[model samples]
Target chain A: MALRNAVAQAAVSVRYVVQRFSLALLVAAAIGVMLIGKADTVLLERARAAALDLAAPLLEALSRPVATINRLIADVEDLANLRAENARLREENARLVTWQSVARRMEVENAELRGLLNFKEGPQATFITARVVGDSGSAFVRSMLLNVGRSGGVTSGQAVVTGEGLIGRITEVGESWARVLLLSDLSFRLPVLVERSREPAILTGDNSQLPRLAMTQSLAGIQVGDRIVTSGHGGSFPVGIPVGVVSSVGEGGVRVKPLGDVLRVEFVRVVDYGITGLVTGPAPPPEVYGPPAPPPRAAATKAR
Target chain B: MGDFLQQLDRWLYAALPGTLVAFLILLTLAPVRLPEVLAVAPLLPLMAVYHFCLFRAEALPAWLLFGLGILFDLLQGGPGTPVGVSALQFLLVRQAILGNQKYLVEVSFTFIWFGYAVLSAVAVALSWCAVSLLMWRFIDPQPAVFQYVVSLFLYPIFGWLIGRGRGRDPLNAPDPRVPGSRP
Candidate 1:
C-alpha cells in the first residue's frame, strides 16, 4: 500500500510540472506551424482545403439561416426604397429601349465583321453558381468561401462575378469549397482597361474599399467615373468583363470603386474561360510590366 | 442505468468548454454579409476563448485550447491568418489566464472587461507582428485596428451568454502557479 501511494504521488507531481511548462511548448508548436505555412504554400493550401471540407456540413446548415436573415434585411430595405425604385425602373426601361436598338445594330455589325474576317468564335464560357457560405472576416486578406468547389468544377484562378460586375477570382479550391480573393485584398492585381479613356492600368488592392490604379499608360485621360474592365491581357479572365469605376483622381493616386457591393454578394458565378494550369495570385503579366508605350494598342488592333 | 447517466453527464461537462468554443468559431464563419459586418465581424471566437479560459480553466485546458485555435484558423479565417497563428494567440490567452488566475477570478464584470480589452490589444498586436514578419512587409494596420475595436465592444454580450452556465460546475481548482495555494 505504501509503495503504490508513493508512486501515485510522484506521478501527480510530475503531471503538475508538465502542465506548467506545457504553455511554452504549445506556443512554440503554434509558431512552428505558421512558419511551415509561410514556407510551403501547397501544404498549407491542402491543409486548409481539408479543414474546410470537414466543416462544410455545419457551415452549410448554418449558412441557410444566415442567408434567410440577410434576405429579411434586404426585403425591409427594398420596401423602404419601393417608391424610388419604381420611378428609377420606369426611367431605366425608357433608356433601355434606345440602348436595345443600339445593341441590335452593334450585333449586326459585329456578326458581319466576324464573317468577313472569318474570326473564330471562342469556346462558350462555362459558369457554376455557388452560394456564399463562408466569409473570411480577415483584416489583412479580403476573401470569401463559396459552397462550390472542385467537385462543382471550380478551379483556382477562375473569375467570379455577379450581375453587377467582377467581384473577385478563385484563389484556392478544395473538393467542396473554394475561396475567392476579393478585389480589395492586398494581393489582388488585375490588368484592366479604362473603358472610355482606353488606358491600361493595374488595379492593386491595398485592403481598402477603393483599390488604387498603378502603372497607368496615361492618367491625363483617366477621370472620375471612368469605367474599368478586365483587359483579358493575362487571359485568366474573359475580355470586357466590367470591374469597377474610377471613384477618385488626385495626387493621392487614382482609386476605383469596385462595381457592386462586394461584401453583400450572395450568389457568385465562377467562370472558366477554358484556361487552366493557373498560377495563384496571377502576377501582373510580363507584357504589362514594360514602360507605357502607347494608348490601348490591343483595342486599336481589334477595331480594324 | 443511473451509472450510465452519470458517466454521460461527466463526459458532457468535460466536453462543454471545447464544444462552446468550437460553435462560436463556426459562427464567425457564417456569411453575415451586412455592409461592414464582413470586414468588421467581431472576433467572436477570441471573446469565447477569453471567457472560458478566465472562468473555466479547469474544463478548457491548454491542449484543447490549441486545437480550438487551429480550427478557428482553418475555418475561413483569412489569408493573413496562417494555420497556426490563431493557435498561438489562443495558447497565449490560456497562459495569461493561468498566470493571472489569482487576480482574475471572482472579479467584477468591469474589471474583467478591462483585462479582456488589454488582452485583445496584445493578441491583435501579436497577429500583426506575426503576419508582418511572415509577409516581410508592413501590412495596413487598419484591419487589425477595426478587428480589435469590434472584438472589444462585443465582449460584454459574449460574456453574458457564456456566463449563463457559470453556475454549473465552474470549479476553480487549485492554482499550480503558486507554490502552495489552495482552491
Candidate 2:
C-alpha cells in the first residue's frame, strides 16, 4: 500500500510540473514574438556588441591559421611567376595606350570648356578608410560591417565606395562598428543615369541576387553594356559615381552588374562629406501657375 | 562573516564564458554569401537556438534571440531582409520543441532527426517566403528553394552529432550560475 501511494504521488507531481512549465513557456514565447516583431536599432546594437564580444576570441584564434594559409597561397602564386601575368598586361597595356591618347585629348577639350563656362566649384568629398571586421553570413542579406564607427567619424547614410566604384552606404553606426548596406540589397535604390544616353532611371533591387532598373523611360535607345553612373539629383549620392554596366536589358527590366564584388570586400572607404552650409538662400516663393514649357532635348545629345 | 563573503563570491560566477565561446565558433563559421544554396552553409543560428533551448533556455531568452535576428538584419542591409521574421521562426521552433518535449525526450535518434528535418524545412521556407514577399517578387523560388531540401537532408546527420556531442559532455551542474564548487 505504501509503495503504490508513493508511485501515484510521483506521477501526479511529474504531470503537474510538465503542465505548469509548458504554460509558463507558452506565455513567455508569446511575449517574445511581440518583442521580436518590434525589433529596432537599439536592439540591433546590443546584439552586435554581444556578437562582437563573443566573436573576438574566435576571430583571434582563427586569424593566425587564415594568415598562414594566405601567405602560403601567395608564395605559390609568386612561384607561378609574373611571366604569364606580364604577358597579359602587356597586351592590355598596348590596347590601353590608344584609349589613353584619346582620353587625354578629351580632357584637354573638357578643360577648355570648363574655362569658358562659369560653373561653380562643388565641395571636395572627404573619405575615411576602414577595414572590414565582419561579413554578413546570410544569403538573403548583402551587407558588411566595418571596424570604423561613430568614434571613427562614420555616420549613417555616408556612401561606402572602393577604388573600383560605389559599393553601398553606411546604414547603422555603433561606437566602434558600422554596417554598410550593399547596393545589391533589395532595399537599396539609387538614381542612376546611362553614361551614353544620359537617360535617368531608378536602380531598384528585388532581392533576386541582382538589382534591376526601374522607371526607365525611353528604353528603345538603351543597350546592354552601357555604363550607369549616379545622378546627383536628390543630393543623396554624388553625381557621376560609377555604379555598374548594364548586364542584361529586357522588356521586363535591365540588370546591372555592380562594380563591387560585395562578397570579398576587405577594405572600404566611407565618404565623410562633412557638415555642409545650410541652404542660406530663402526658398523661392510658391510658384504661380504658368504655362508648361517645351520638352527639353536629351542632355547627352547637347553634350555630344 | 568569512563564510558569508565566500558564499557571496561563489554566487557571482557563471557559465557565460563557455556559452559565448560556443557562439563565437558558430559566428565565425556562419557563411555570408548570396545564392543561399551555394554560398551559405547550414543554419548557425539554428544550432545556437537548439543548444540554448535544450541545454540552457535561461541563457538564450527570447528577447536575446530576437535581438540576434536584428543584428543579422543590420548586417544584411538589403531590402526585405527579415530579422523579425527569422526571430519569429526561431521562437516558434523553440516552442514546438518545448511542446513536444514529453514525447521527444523518450524518442530515439531517428525520431529526433526526422522531427528536426521537418521543423527546419518549415522554418527556412517561411523565411524565404517572407523575404520574397518583402521584395515583391513572385519569381521562381528555384535554387534557394532547394536550401530547405538541403536542411532536411542534413538534419539527421546534424541531429545525431548534436545529440552525441551533448551526451558525451557532462551536464551543466544545477548551479551553473554559482562560482566555485562547494566542498
Question: Which parts of model 2 are misplaced by more than 4 Å?
Answer: A1-90, A116-119, A274-304, B1-37, B51-84, B101-113, B129-167, B171-183
Q: Top TM-score: which candidate number?
A: 1
The sequence of per-residue lDDT tens digits that candidate 2 reaches over residues B119-160 is 777777777777666555663454345555665566566556
Best by lDDT: 1
| TM-score of model number 1 | 0.86
Interface RMSD of 1: 1.6
DockQ for each model: 0.53, 0.18
After superposition, which runs of candidate 1 have C-alpha atoms over 4 Å from their true positions? A1-17, A277-304, B170-183
The lowest-lDDT stretch of 10 consecutive residues in candidate 2 chain A is A275-284
Docking tier of model 2: it is incorrect
TM-score of each: 0.86, 0.68
- Model 1 complex DockQ against the native: 0.53
lDDT (C-alpha, whole model) for all candidates: 0.83, 0.64
| Tens-place lDDT digits, model 1, residues A3-56 | 999999999999998887788888888888888888888787788878888988
> Residue A218 error for model 2, in Å?
1.8
